[model samples]
Target chain A: MKSLLSVQSHVAHGYVGGRAATFPLQYLGWDVDNINTVNFSNHTGYGHFQGSAIPEPELIKLFQGLNQIGCSYDVVVLGYIPSAELIDVVASEVAALKKSNPSTRYVCDTVMGDQGHLYVNNSCVDAYRKLLSTKIADVITPNQFELELLYGKPIDSEKLLRDAIAYMHDTYGVDHVVISSLDASVLNLQELQLICCAVSSRFKERSQEQSQLQVFLVPEIKSYFTGVGDLFTALLADKLFTNNGNLVLAVNQVLTIMSNVLKLTHQLGIKEFTQHYGEDSCERLAEGRMNDGESMRFFELRIIQAREFYDYSGAGEFSAIEISN
Target chain B: MHRNLLSILSHVCHGYVGNRACVFPLQCCGWDVDTVHTTNYLNHPGHGTFQGEKNDGRTISTIIEGLKKLFDLREYYNVVLVGYCPSAEVMTAVYEELEPIYKTKDRKEGPVFVVDPVLGDNGRLYVPEEVVQVHIDFLKRGLVDLTTPNQFEMELLTDTKFLSWNDVKSACYKFYDTYKVPDFVILSVLIDEQMYSVGFSASTETVFYVPIQEIRCRFSGCGDIFTALLTNEFYSNGRVLSPQVLTLVVDKLHRILLTSFREERARLGRDPDVIHDINLVRLRDLFERSFGGDLEVKYL
Candidate 1:
């Protein structure tokens, strides 16, 4: 069995961070060791969350414990580090793991914020820049905002986005770069259609002229959901490893599973909302104007219910569109 | 529908003990588990060299308080499982935070509190005496609906010596009458080369025993896994304990242990007398399989 070290936030009530990531990986046959960066009551998207980020010293001590036990992992996945200092600690620990094994794959989700909002400290951007400069991360799944942050510029057009992917590959030696979500305006696409792009360095090495990019179009669900990014990164990591570094195949499978999960979550959320506040509440839910804590409960990802979709390898409903620059 | 569970336990980074052993199995069985870790160790101490520290009681209280802010614990979770608190302060903090939910809950409706009083094994106390005292107080207050204790902890809880089945039966009754806990399971009872898990159900007013196959290798996380599976089965069977549930749980556990033993032996090319971390991921299917042919259950 493959072993993975998952470093992320942990909420006691819902699926996010490590809670969202650990189960799917374990179900897909990986031994996951979790290091919770924070222990919150629920996700911060709820607007009223209780809990604090785990102190840096405590985080360091957990790593030291893993080292003392001679624990080594085949993959290390990083998510939701609250501070720049913690990010530095993670970078150093992951560097050490790579140095020791020389084959340990690092999957990093640069979880600063989504849709132009920054939840973590701004300094974390610099920390991530420094970490990526080391080229320790073998795979990175960054949303459009995080990709722009790390590339040190705006990716407002498809051409700019392609340049940014190429920059990540050339500068950081990143083996795989997956743009988890793109702004619809960047590609001038339909409002309800979301795009995901992936590029693999192996493909770039195979062809000298231009890198091959795979784009997947996904339908946007009307309700707000948390932990989608965390879950996507986790499933991608498992699939990438299992599919032997085939980025197109892995991302295709991951998106299929994600689409299925989102569809189920939206259906369940609507059912729950109607049950609580009558059928009229469906409009309020679709508008993303859930005001109270009770409504927030309905938005949690139906992760456990969607377990069967994790190993789904059927013909991809969202097949990748091959793009060459 | 997926059932929700709150698991307060230890977390080891490398091994399957406490939450490490409990969470995956429970999740695979369709439980949404939220965990508050008591200690974060490198691995279980069975490895002889361990690292990590026990979390502060204040941290435990704070996390629980955070959960309470977002959820009505009574309504959110179907089961609350507590196991392996390393310190008395931590244990007390758990009780103080959870007592309110227990107080307001209707016992027959839902949200059963299952405590595995993990003090020690085989006539020894690994934890400090204060921690043991805290567990005693928690049980005596009737804060727990059900508890799974090993033979040694059962002795400590009831202050009785289990020389035979009769002694075990009396202790079970004593526990129920004194603590007001309706159900109890004494894990890993060995008599004349046969292993059994003896249990008492208040609703049924009966004492019964389920035979367990003895794997030669000693495993660290068996008790934690047992408690997790027991809680799952107990909740699934309408919050009640029966011979059928016990038999199914024991049978599943036996298969897992046997698989772990055989795998460890094959890997080492020798007899593995003590297995540190059992392979739950490789044995994932065992947790999902439906076991038929209930073991011969005998009444005391």
Candidate 2:
């Protein structure tokens, strides 16, 4: 069986970070070792949370202790590192892991900021860039804003996005780059879809005019949810490890599971909204200004409640568009 | 009311034990489980050595207090499961901290506190003797509605040496009669080659004995798993009908243990990395058994 070392934040009340990702990977038959960075009462999107962050020295001690115990993993997934110092420590550890076992896969979720806002410290961007410069990570999943943050420019168009991917490949030597979300205006499509693009460092030589990007599109669910990215990164990394770097198949597998989860989440959220307020209160709430807290309470990813969807292997009607640019 | 549960136990990062062994099974049973970690470690200490700190009374009480402030403990959970209180300080803190909340709750609608007094196994105590004393004192206070202890813990609690079924039954009755705990289960009563568990419900004024074939395997967290299964089954079955609940829980645990052994054998066959004599599962199949409910049980 494969083993995964998941370094992320933990919440006692709700699912996010390690709490969100660990179960699905375990259900997929991987032995999971979870290192919690913060033991919070709940996720922070609720606007009220209480807990303490694990200090950097303690984190180092824990990792070193694992090493002393001869605990090695096939994959090390990094998510929600709370401090730049801890990020540095993680990078060094990942490098050491790769040096010891060249077959070990390193996946960096690059969880800095998303949707035109930076939720973590601005120093995290530098930390991520420094980690990427190590060239030890095999897979990096970053949203559009995070992609632009890495390249230090706005990827406002298809041309710029492709340039950024190529730059990451050329400069950082990372193999697979996954943009988990893209602005709909880039494609000029109606009925907005949550599209993810998977690009490989080994691009086709005949694709000077044809894009080598595999685009996976799923219909968007209109509710605020957290931990979607964490779940996506986990599934993507598991698929990549199992399939031996087949980006297309990995992306399709993740999308199938995610789409089902989101659809169920949205339905449950609407049901909760109607239950709490009245029949059609979800419509009333949807027709007005969106409240993130209220919407999130109704949504909350439904990760634990709708856990059966994690085993979905079919992509359904969703298929990848192999763009040639 | 909703089937919500609050579990206070140990959380291990690597292997399943304590809440790691308890929480997932309850969740799979469709209960909303909220957990407070008494301590967090890399793996069970039975693995030779482990890392992480013992979450002290202050830290634990703070987390529980935080939960109360946010969710109003009495309103949020219908079942409170306690296990492995590592220290007398922590045990006292847990009781004093939650006493007010339970007191405020309407008794008819309040949470049912089920204590698994985890002191020691195999004729010894793992934690300090004061921890055992604290547990006895807590039970003496009649705060817990249910308590599950193995033979050694039961012996320690009642301070009795039982050589037969009648002695063990009298010890259980004496415990309930003294502590006023409405329900008590003595997990593992050994007679000759067979092992039996005694479940007694004072409310129904009944007792039941469940015996299983003694499989020679050493695995951590069986006690924790059995406690979780008992808590959920008792709660869902309306806390009465002790015989039926105990039978179901024991049968499920036996089946899961068999599955774990089979899985371990299969794992050793495929993976050359695993050395023999290591418990491959170490309580890893809570989720696997969550969806498993088809085990046929013929109660003897």
Candidate 3:
């Protein structure tokens, strides 16, 4: 059986980070070795949570013990490093493991911030840039803001986005880069749009020569959802590993699953609001009047409720097309 | 409506044991499980040298406190399942933190507390003796709504050693009589070369047995898996520990164990007797074969 090492944050209450990633991988039949960078009372989305981050020393000790076990994993999915120091530790560890088995895939989700807001310390961005420079990760999943950050410039137009993708490929030597979520309003698309991008190369005899970008445009869901990125990275890794690094198929499969999950999340969120504030308040809830406390129950990605959808047959109801430059 | 389960148990990164063994199957059966780890280890201790640390009682208390803050406990969970509390301190902390939810009678109905009294098996104790005492005290206080104890735990709880099937049966009855535990199942007893699992319900005051075909595989986490199957079956069957439930539980357990045993043997290219560990990943695949269908019980 294939195996994955999932290193991320852990929440005791709700799913995020490791909690969000491990289950779907397990359901897809991967033996997962999980190391939590932080153990929190719940996801920070709760506004109030308790618990502490696992110190760098303890994390290193745990990894060393696993190394002693002499088990190699097919993939390693990293997310939500709480500290820059921890990121350095993870980078060294991934470097050593990849050196031992060059075929092992590293799926890195540069989880720094969302919607133009940075959550971690500023040093973390530098650490991520340093790690990406090593080109240790096989696949990188970054949203628009993270893409802009990594590019070291604001991506305000399609030209800049395309340039950023090419720069990342040429500079970082990353085999595949998936921009999971990009605001479509930047492109002046017809109704509030979300653009997902996947860039991969058709290596001619082990040399990086030809590359193509597949763009997926879909109407964005109206509600803000936590754990979507974590879930997306996990599903993307699964599809990529199973599909033999087919970037287009992986992006399509992940978006297909995400669409179902987010759609259910929005419906559940709306139903929770309508039940409490009457049916007339639906528009108000959509207008973003909902607080974290009021929408906590609904905003949760209905992963468990939509468990069967994970086994979805071959990328349902979503497709991506190659973008010509 | 969906059922929610809160499972507090040991977490091993390598193999499925304790909550690792229980959570996936329960989720496969369509319950949303919230897990709190009592200890974190690289693998089950049976694999010999392992790393990781035990979560102190305070950590368990903090997580439970967080749960209380985030959820209206009465309406949030349908089942609270406790397994493999490593130390007496952690066990006591969990019981105290959960006591109100288990003890409270107001605001609709409270969640059912299912305890798998995980002291030890095969006449040996894995945890410190204090933890065993804590489980007995908790049982005596009538805190556990349902419990599945092995023959040794039943013997310890009743202060009786099993000399025969009747002796084990009397001990279970005495435990029910003394503590008035709503439901109890005595698992893994060998009587006259035949393996049997005995169950008793205080509501009925009757005892029943489900015979198990002895497989050579002695894998860890069988008790944990048994308790989870019991919890799922009994909860869905209107909270009855009837013979039917026992038969269903044993049937599923038998198939899983048999398949795991055979698969491990085949993978090792050896006899089943030489296989020491069950492949949980394989077991999960076998279980998912009949995921949504009604589990058939041919023994009944």
**TM-score for each predicted model, relative to the true structure:** 0.96, 0.90, 0.94
TM-score of 2: 0.90
Model 2 agreement with the true structure over B112-213: per-residue lDDT tens digits: 888899999889898888998788777887667788989898888888877877777778888888788888887788866678878888776666687775
DockQ of each model vs. true complex: 0.73, 0.41, 0.56
Better of 2 and 3 by DockQ: 3
Candidate 3 residue lDDT tens string, A212-248 = 7767886675536788899989998898888888888
Docking class of 1: medium
Q: B146 in model 1: Cα distance from truth in Å?
A: 1.1
TM-score per model (chain B) = 0.97, 0.88, 0.92
The superposed Cα distance between candidate 1 and the true structure at residue A249, in angstroms, equals 1.1
Clashing pairs in 3: none
lDDT of 3 by residue, B57-119 (tens): 998898888878787776788988999888999999999988877675542267887899888
In angstroms and one decimal each, the interface RMSD of every candidate reads 1.5, 2.9, 1.5
Report the Cα lDDT for candidate 1.
Answer: 0.85
**All models: lDDT?**
0.85, 0.75, 0.79
RMSD of each: 1.9, 3.8, 2.8
Please give the distance, in angstroms, between residue A254's alpha carbon in candidate 1 and its true position after superposition. 0.6
